[model samples]
Target: MNRVIKDTGSKYPIIQAPMGWIARSQLASAVCEAGGMGIIETSSGEIDNCKKEIQIMSELTDKPFGVNLPLLFLKDDSMVKFCVEAGVRFVTTSAGDPTKYIKVLKDAGITVYHAVPSLEGSIKAANAGVDGLVVEGTEGGGFKSPVEVGLLVLIQSIKQNLDLPIIAAGGIVDGAGMAAVFAAGAEGIQMGTRFVSSA
Candidate 1:
């Protein structure tokens, strides 16, 4: 079995990007129902509303889903505690050091993937003990690294250095794009722009 499928528990090796307020239950549930992993976003820092969204996801789709923790945007660890207590099985952390909450989330039995923009970041995340890496390239929308490495190059470079399951995120939209990433050595794909239109 694909490690991405084993890690995410989604039928497809696809994850809907957790885009701020837009990545709420309504959008996430649809993705889940379509057999892709849907992720609720805490990046918006609307903690209470995001929690409500997570609950709504349970009622909306029984399919496996996830939540993203944008460490730079988070004001506290309350959301982490919430996910742990709520029994969220999967999570992706970005915008800060992966080492900070890795132990707690892992100890809770959560499968954690950290988003990284460069080879150095990917290596650091792997060393920090993340289960996988969401390798976001320069083409990806929203926040990005100062270094502008493209998706294919980033995925290939990281794959050569670290033997970790990678969920490539960037300009991928259709099957052709997915195939391109897979050929570049990524095990899965994460789509944000396409899903924004989906929502």
Candidate 2:
């Protein structure tokens, strides 16, 4: 198994990225049960609902799973505290400075992954000591910016500069695409559309 999968205890190197608003426990646990890393989206500011869904995920699968917390959307530490108390071991943070929560999560023995859309962001995240980086290409889907890097370039650049595990995200919806990213030096692939579409 790839380091990313092994680190998260998933049977496969595929990660179902928490695709904004739509990512919930049902699909997240299903992915986990299917041997892929699954992530619950908790950026909606609904702490209660997040806990409820996490509880549901816990009941449905014994496999490890994670949560996606968009720093830009989260207003406090409620969700973070909740996950830790609930025994979540992996967390993927996007769209904000990771320094704020990276230490908190790491101190509690949690692996943290930050989604990066630019080389600068990748370097910064690596410096912050993240467990991994999810290089989200403009092609995959993310914050709309005139400056968007595609997976090919972003993954290569990150691989060339960073030693941490890399998970490729964006524009990949199948095995061929996953293989291409892995060949490009990514340890895993974070897929959203394939599962979201099927759901």
Candidate 3:
């Protein structure tokens, strides 16, 4: 089985990008039902609301799902505790260093994948013992590095330097784009804009 599928426990190697506000129970549960990994987003900084959504996701779908922790936006460790207490099995950390919460999450048996826009970040995440990488290229929407490295080059560069599973994010919207990322060495794909319109 594909590493992403195995790690995520989803039927498809597709992960929905945890876009703020948009990535909640309704869309996430739908993604889970459709066999893709659904992720609850904490980027909105609405901790209480996000927790409610996580609880709602449990009632909405039996399929495995995940959550995203954008570290930079966090005000405290409450979000981490929320995920661990909620029994979340998978999480993607972004907007900060992966090392900050790797041990705590891993200690709770959560699989961790860090979002990165550069090879340096990828290396740092991999070395931090994250289970995988969400390799966000410059083309990806929302917040990203100022440097403009396209998906192809970014994917190839990370794959060449690290053996961690790469979930390519940025500019992928269809089967053709997914195929293109896989061909470049990514094991899975994360789509934000496409999924926003999808649900």
Which candidate should be chosen as best, given lDDT against the real structure?
1
The root-mean-square deviation over C-alpha atoms between each candidate and the true structure, in angstroms, is 0.6, 1.2, 0.7
| Residue 187 CA displacement from its true place in model 2, Å | 0.8
For candidate 3, the 10 contiguous residues with the lowest summed lDDT are: 190-199
- Tens digits of per-residue lDDT, candidate 3, 1-199, equal 7899899999999999999999999999999999999999999999999999999998999999999999999999999999999999999999999889999999999999999999998999999999999999888999889878888999999888989999999999999999999999999999999998883
Q: Which digits, one per residue and each the tens of the lDDT, describe model 2 over residues 77-194?
A: 9888987888889999998889989988998899999988888998999899898998888897646446778889989988888888999998899989988999999999998777
What are the models' TM-scores?
0.99, 0.96, 0.99
Clashes of 2: 2
What ranking of all candidate models by lDDT puts the best one first? 1, 3, 2
Ranking 1 against 2 by lDDT, winner: 1
Inter-residue clash pairs, candidate 1: none
Clashing pairs in 3: none
Model 2: CA > 4 A from native: none
Q: In model 2, which range of ten residues has the least summed lDDT?
A: 140-149
